[model samples]
Target chain A: MNQIDGKSARALLLILSTFTYLLFGAMVFDKLESEEDTRVRDEIERITDRLKNKYNFSERDMHLFEAIAIKSIPQQAGYQWQFAGAFYFATVVITTVGYGHSAPSTSAGKLFCMVFALFGIPMGLVMFQSIGERVNTFIAYSLHKFRDSLHQQGFTCLQEVTPTHLLMVSLSIGFMVIVSGTYMFHTIEKWSIFDAYYFCMITFSTIGFGDLVPLQQADALQAKPLYVFATIMFILVGLAVFSACVNLLVLGFMASNADEVTAANREPPSAIVLERFARNSLVESQLFNIQKHSTVGVLPGRPRRMYSIVPNSAGDVHLRRRSTRRSIQDTVCCGCFKPRPPRYRFSLTRRPTNISHLVDLELY
Target chain B: MNQIDGKSARALLLILSTFTYLLFGAMVFDKLESEEDTRVRDEIERITDRLKNKYNFSERDMHLFEAIAIKSIPQQAGYQWQFAGAFYFATVVITTVGYGHSAPSTSAGKLFCMVFALFGIPMGLVMFQSIGERVNTFIAYSLHKFRDSLHQQGFTCLQEVTPTHLLMVSLSIGFMVIVSGTYMFHTIEKWSIFDAYYFCMITFSTIGFGDLVPLQQADALQAKPLYVFATIMFILVGLAVFSACVNLLVLGFMASNADEVTAANREPPSAIVLERFARNSLVESQLFNIQKHSTVGVLPGRPRRMYSIVPNSAGDVHLRRRSTRRSIQDTVCCGCFKPRPPRYRFSLTRRPTNISHLVDLELY
Candidate 1:
């Protein structure tokens, strides 16, 4: 369709434009700031030279002071505009996840940052939206397939897999990532497990707290480019996973409160529809769509009385009822297969009309 | 109503849970990390005392090394778990905009960060959404009122203000914020105008490149709690502003490329719906909603000779057309308002029936 094509084109334009802006920023920063940096470094050298002369400093003392001087000065030196730092700068700029470890120092660089970010931030959001959605949907599709396979292999026969199950799985996966990152960082930094975990959590969350950064080891610093690249992958994938978990959470919240009634007849649980609602919450809108959803419980075929309030236009909320009061048995995965009796005694006395009303009911 | 109440209730529940978690984390971190911090400080003090006696070091040299020792230490001097830090930690946790200036150093603290973020980020998103949407709608309402007043004053007889005009106004407003922020920061930091602007861009964008942070003055550092609190306000309101601008950009992109047919006559340009595209893109689904569109550029009453490919349920793309093109005029604002003749000269060849084919055009 022209719509999709047009959008894809516009998106491409935005990306290309962003790259051009980034390169421009990088070049301007390198050209303008590298000299200022050298001048500052020269000034430090002069001061230390004067101190060495004035204090009758021995070679060892001079060496010590020189090291201190080097440490105190901004470490960027002359390489700020080079590929590694520029690439890192580019990532920081676009993501708006400023590590604060490195930045554009010159006036031009600052101006460029303002101008560049004016375009870059939205472009970044679009990128994240595009990538995050794909990654989320792909993960969901995979999970669905895994569930389907489980059913096929006689693992279990459930009508619909709930968000609770998905959330647990995703959370488990996230926890695993944190644990593994902790191990890796602890090994590399030779820090306590606690410190490593803290670094990973902070980094993965896009907080870039910069308090505990990596590759301060002199040898490791030699490969700053590689380090930056690896971290970018880590952050991107970590965010994608976190987003998927959040997506499942959003879905869980939306679907948690379906008060279903059991009866002698019912239709099968339909697949969840991923509809588009425009906001920054791409995942939340994609969460639990209630178009034709009736009994969102474990046993879909069991006839149940369900009251769902769907918000319709013109200031009216449409309350649909699929009512049946029959006790149903659901065999859930706990350890062994056992049929659990569904509770039909509890039901909501209040029927809500609109979204606000449904929200009022704590239906989630 | 109940649903809204329920969501609000759930949201509150999430906040309460997060607070409890934060308290637990703060207490645990205080108990565990304080001992470690004290041990390090004791060692540093012992070494300095011994050094003072071991060698007849100059007082100035002793002072210099002391400064170095303090700087090299991790700066969390028994203050990590205090209320001020804990509250700051909470903001970092929820926003995921980790400044990394201060972080939890204990295993319990690390675990808490992971757990807290799992719930807090969503809550933050919801809060941001609520605030941002309210702010957006309010601005739109105010803008509408301004336009209404303008119409009443006989500025123009236009029935509706175009998205382009509104976009320019918002953009100008956003730029003004940047310029004003730059000025404020420059005076406070005693930095060049460019550096100030850069810092603002980096900070507000959430990249937070720590190279140029705020409130480093001696007095400000003494009042660290107030500084943190103020900075929190700065970040929150800045992010809200950024979100609003992005929302408008999303609207502009979605509404810009309308394939409208010109009639013998036309109505004025109506405002874009911007109602509920509940994701980062607030306008995608809105652009194509043609039911109420009156001034769609090309023609009013007469239809356009345009081919559209709509996707069907069975993996097939359907090509449909409602054709009959006539000339139209559009009044757009640059510096001044001018009516431009609609171009009927440019037309597409090789009308695509599928997404892939349309993508092949590379319209960008």
Candidate 2:
């Protein structure tokens, strides 16, 4: 899709999805406002009040309880504001932004959310996936020169690196950035070390739980602009760094077999490997000899060769082949080497030259 | 990790994560209880009250406003219950339950949430991945004998089969089970189709948003036994079906190339396929050439060979591979035997040879 069309489609989807959520939210509000809901609420309040009076709740306790009760009620607001918040929340939740401020309470609400998430999460994933792919392409393109420079410097196996290593590298850079940024944020916002670290963690993760938001409170009035600017820059830079890390990690994971290739090139199989093959062959041959004279009736013949042992100086190791014919065993192991002890043996009418006969050998 | 250890670790993580959230909740609640917090609350309330009075909100409007306001409040109980609810919310949000009954209002809350999700989501993913691996190993072991029985009857490409198809097969069986079970739930719960579907979706997704929780609101006489039975069955069958689907999906995504051993098994490359390969090769060559040249410039002289191709067919197609020691150019022909002009030339150097370049190539 063209950028405009793609964006419009996204907008439309967002609108429709938000509308659906609001419709549900409205329904829920209506339901809770009903006589039955009111009765339940009243009963719960009464029970809680009795408990409070009996126990003598502190002023702090009363305030906390009252705050929760107040927050539980849905607000009447303009569709624009409510929808904006809801859509934003939806985006945050699916994107893993989570901003734990708002969440479902009723079992039915939670249930619906789970249902919404099944499709919504995947859709969100596709969005991130698309962005990630493009970002990766760009990074690969830009890093091409840098990598080439490194190549000239005799850096081999650059492409064969592990995700963990790449993650560590990126994380080191990210850690430095976070620490420096957190320190700066602390100076600007004057939050404790734990709070600053916590804020950083929450922001980068996109949890946005809202409990510890920056630049929202009234205290840091003088540094508001600086704090806001820093917050934005931190998020932008942090995201870019994070995205780069993700790209590297993904590429590293996808290139997991690179090490195998390097190993293969470094060391070719030795003649000793061949000798081990031959020893395995001798074992199979002796088992086959015993199977030929077995008393049990022969099983139906397979159409394809089940196993092949190429004679080498080391010994013979069985190589199982894919079966093309119907009724042929997909497994190609010799009967003699079967892990299980055989109680009966199949007596073939003819001694088959093909590897299929390997299956007829029985274990005592 | 041992099963017991694994279980306990998971439990501990869950508890710790929940506790951390609870601590945050209490802190926020404490803040909101302070004189300053109360002032902010009053300001917001005044603004909302003005909006409500000026708009002359209807009863429905009043309900919506009340709901939103209730959700906007920070805390409603002691640390224990607040922790319990927050823990449940965290689980629901991560699991995608999203009941929507409670959500964030403040910017700080929303922002903090985003940060929380970044780490939590990935952690959850790792946990799920490990669990999935174990479950797959177990399933594979158990199915080994049954699969052998089928193989004895002669089945091919079973290993190469896609997981999507397997999922389809599983879903067919799962559908029947769900249909019968949902019907029973409907009979027992007397919910409408929308509510029933909603319930099923929520339960299956494990969001359990709780807005429409089952059995909790049922008549006291029937609630005890029925609720217990439903809960047990839901947990048991829900996990089974979920694991099965995950197993099948993983199987489907695994590479089938490793299983195909035939020398003549090479499939003809589709046009799109060839184009992608060519693009990837060009990029790789460019990168390699750039790196080599840069290295050679620094080293003064280095023996390198460039694998290059020139277009044989009519058109502007040219293929070139250049290295410090040698360069090769060959004629390139497009699938339709048409030639195209070169768009741009850029080189990458120091690229990892073992890296599977094709993964970066987009087939779509």
Candidate 3:
């Protein structure tokens, strides 16, 4: 496949997989967990019966009493693959947050979880990475363009002030997300802003301490699905902005060292042509798209040089120039490029820059 | 820093960080939670007094009576970061488990968590990866040596059978951890083995449900510190073996294709000198102390060309033969090899095998 086409499809695959995954997970979890769910409900009702007799509460009032008391039940708690619960489960699984508030109780559910995680975790990562790049490229391009626009308007300090400016903007934006979410959670959960802030921080980091879960209010059970939906939006946006901040951090680090890299190698851009050999859609940006809709081009022959941008350590852009001879060997005979002894090769390419990457690069 | 030395130091750092982090976390949590602990005790006493007045339960039976009634009190739940609780909190924070069964309720605690995570998460990952590599390399070398011993005994099929054999052995070893853990948990918690199995799976995956935590007996809280210590050991070993499996999978996949790779590249082994240029101790492996003890040598002139081993997108090991001219440039002029346009570069390295890496490399 043309790498660009392949890259573009990968992002779509993330969405497609999520929908199909959710559909199947919901069905399977409901199936596997229903028996256990029924037992839990039965036990709760039986206890309610005993409590009503002991406390002299009415049958209708007994349910309210059980709903309140059921929280004390050590085992067989609720949220067993009910739609809200299942959706919540799926979110945590894909995000790899795995709060364990609820889990697959049956063998079948366990098998399904193993199978689901095998694919879903990678799928989620790809989606996060792709969207993160788009977000980063958007920010980088915007900041660059903003700087250019300012320069055009005779504001000349952008060259010196740009990194700090970008960081400030990114930090403020990330904090805004925290503040806004804190307010919403504060109002809804009647938690103090401190509690809300703590929750947001825990969540966006994907630590997902189940202690501060939503749908806790007695009144919210009827609107459980809506709550899940809101929670989803809350998490996704938080993740995106959080990822953007991380990207900005990387760029900031790189820009800080940009002077050193540029100063060290003013030797007319080496004839060496480093290509980003990654599966990520960042290579799709080889044919730059300003947005998903608007396609643009780097001047035909002088396409901009890209190094590995995303940090997950999977689709690192290979900086080694594919020599023409190697390119031919790559096409006519495929294995030459695939089996180069990487152990020795990394040692051979021991420049200071590569060494820096060794530290900065996440092995994932 | 030499890559081998760096990698070697990393494992030690993990242990060191855990101790320092635990010491600080324990101190902080104990300080923060002591106030709340007293409040909870007071509330429990007051509630016991109310129940004692209403139901004529004896003062000697206060704890048993409240153990039943204590379930009703919503505020001031258990798991306060006393020495035991604090230790658990530190484990979750470093591991990114964040079970939230017991989070810091105080503002100081919350702030500390964020700061702690900012450093600890990355620290933990580095340690996991380093330890995982050491574990993998040890296993691989041992298995290889084992196979050689079998061959010395005149076994012919050893080469063909080794990879699969190693996998089976590794798998059995991993399963053994689970079974032993299940047994211990079942006996301790008086849960069925099936429930124990569920807890182990949940805990190892870092999902940490908090639903079936250990040492729940009224007699056990007095030994809560001991229980916490046991839980830490269980989690650490589980994480270590689990990580080792993941690393092995990467090697296993690459080794699976070893035949195809060797068959495809039959040209005289190019004079490719592969030096492991890690900031890790893997290059220290070049000075092999088989299992962190004895030292060895890299044959001075004839270096083995290594290939890309781990498929994680970041820091992919590239197998390239360093040509004489490039070697000079690499040594004399450090920057010449570093500057390459990344955009057109990925497109330039198109080959069928490379495309497969795009898919197969990310099985993680």
Candidate 4:
């Protein structure tokens, strides 16, 4: 109960923090852009008034003209509901980048889009995370192999690959992707380099304000198939790489947070036993009595298997079963419910040379 | 290595699946909306030509008129970089809705926006997840306490809260928020009920297509402060509720997937021991000799304390430590690195009454 309260308090605090951050961002933006916004508004208004005076257009006709002009901007891209444009739109929707360059105008189209995104977004999220994890793992494996080759060459440098090494690799890859994308967009779209870079940042982050969407001018979506393909690939691949960085960063952050939480919330042990097993130390013998209990899913009165790990300090780890009969009891309260009290026991000891093997115990 | 290969293969498969899904969605959207898109394009072109003929305007003048008209749409919302509108934009950016209603026009604003988003998006993500988790925990605790009260009143009808119950509650809350938002937008913005509902869905999904954005209709950002506040609250609160539903669903999905992966990848046990303690059965003499090994974090040559949990049959659990001196050997390889082989041991044993407490073991 106390744990729940603590978590709730933390969540409330985070909510407050986010709102405060938003307010701060808003103030900064207003300070930076309000004058520019006013200037643009006045310039556009002056142009509109000049055009109205030159054309001598009626109020209703001028309104209709503005409506037609505003509506025509997206149509200038040429056949947005055609296969190529539709595919681009699909990618945008699933990614939640949602450039809003071309949206479904028909009611049926809108309904289908919602239904499609309902499934597609989650699928995209899972797919991106999976690919991201694979990328990280590949980087780690490559680093390990590189270190091994260095060791073989008698250079006692570039040791084991840590999470930090993987993070650095992913960050560099992400940077390279952004730089290449910025260059490509600048060359092909005739956008200034800084604008191209900003677009890359916005698109990759999935904010995608769409103020300067690609493939909209000169009917590029239909005319320049290669540019279109490159743009789509860049968006997809860049997102995957960014997801890799995010995965590593979030995992590290969460692990440290978990340690802090445990330290703060854990009850002190009644008895302390000091045990030490230094790294590179050859152990003589260590036996781990493994105990697993089925709490949720197992048929009542069914026989369950148990095994202990006997790591022979000098040889391979062995699994041994202790043949002991224990009498079974079934109380079977409402739906066989059992209320368990919260009990936490903290222990620190050393058994083997393999930390990875110990972490893999999570598979159970 | 085999596990990594399997994971890579799975990621590759997911990527392929998502691409195929995108292709399928594209084909369907093309079939549904292509004809309507053509009709709208033709209508807009006809109106533009008619106006051009009526006014007999030069090509350059007509082009300038269209540009001015297009630029004026955002200005219609009234001073977009003002405090209220800027706050709305900030909200949109961090939540990743990115409505594209009014993006930063100045280079400084754009640079600031990117930097702000670099930190704000992650913070928002963490905040939402934390709130979602807290909401679930609160619901579970409330349900548990309610069940306890029922039992005390001699009802004993309701059981413990499950993940399914929490999901349902969250889904209902999400549904209510959407319905209420739809009604409010329909009444205030004067949009069709279906369009209002669609707007709510798009906004809450963080898609923010901007086709039917709420506040841009009648200068609502500046003129209707109460409405603006309501819309912002709806977005933030709705996202939080949906996150709670997503949290429950994703966790349940992942838990089942983890179980499947473990079952498929785990090697067959070399030996087996049978033990059974049914639900509501009082555990007797369950001594968990927790041989905790300090794998990563502890000063070299420092003594780490170890403890064992001895759960008494007739009383609360007890902690006991057996004192024994064991000689330590420090191999001290490169950086004192210790390579651990992959070792998995499976065991089933009787445990004390708290399953939550056992699951909380992950905190370590």
Instruction: By DockQ, rank the candidates, best first.
Output: 4, 1, 3, 2
Q: Kindly report which residue stretches of model 1 are placed more than 4 angstroms away from their true locations once superposed.
A: A1-82, A114-118, A224-229, A247-364, B1-93, B104-119, B157-159, B221-231, B250-364
For residues B1-364, write the lDDT of model 4, one tens digit per residue: 4444566688989999999999999999999999999998889989888988999999999889888888899998787888899999999999999999999988999999999999999999889878876666566555556766787899956543344555677788899999999999999989999999999988888988888887887778899999999999999999988988876666444333322322222111110000001001222322211111111111122133221222231121111111111111121111112321111121111332322233336533
How does each model score on TM-score?
Answer: 0.52, 0.37, 0.52, 0.74
Q: How would you encode candidate 1's per-residue C-alpha lDDT over B1-364 as one tens digit per residue?
A: 4222443354355435433433343343334333443454455456445544655567886555434433322221223334444554466556666655555544445565667665566556545544444445555555556766886798865454444554566566667777876776687668788777776666666677666655544434335565556655666666656656555554333223111111212222223323221111222342233211212221112222111211111011000111111211121121011221111111112222222222323222
Per-residue lDDT tens digits for candidate 3, residues B1-364, read 6322443355345434433433343343334433444454455446445544654544544333233332322212332333344555566666666665555544665677777667656555545544554555455556556655887899866553233454566577778988988998898778888778877766666656565666545435335556656766777667767766654554333222221212222211211101111112223333211110100110111111111211221121112222322332332222111232231123212233433333323322
Evaluated on CA atoms against the true complex, candidate 3 attains a DockQ of: 0.07
Measured by DockQ, the strongest candidate is 4
The regions of model 3 sitting more than 4 angstroms off are: A1-80, A100-115, A160-172, A219-221, A224-227, A243-364, B1-80, B160-172, B219-221, B224-227, B247-364
For candidate 1, please provide the TM-score of chain A on its own: 0.49
| Candidate 2, residue B314: lDDT | 7
Full-model lDDT for every candidate: 0.44, 0.38, 0.45, 0.65
Off-target runs (Cα >4 Å) in candidate 2 are A1-83, A96-118, A133-144, A147-165, A172-364, B1-127, B130-165, B169-364
lDDT of 4 by residue, A1-364 (tens): 4444566688889989998999999999999999988888889978888888998999999999989988888898777888889999999999999989999989999999999999999999889878786777567656656776887899876644445566788899999999999999898889999999999998988988999888887888899899889989999999999988876776444333322322222111100000001100212212211111111111122122221221231121111111111101121111112321111121112322322232335443
> Which ten-residue region of model 1 chain B has the weakest summed lDDT?
B313-322
The iRMS of model 1 comes to 24.4
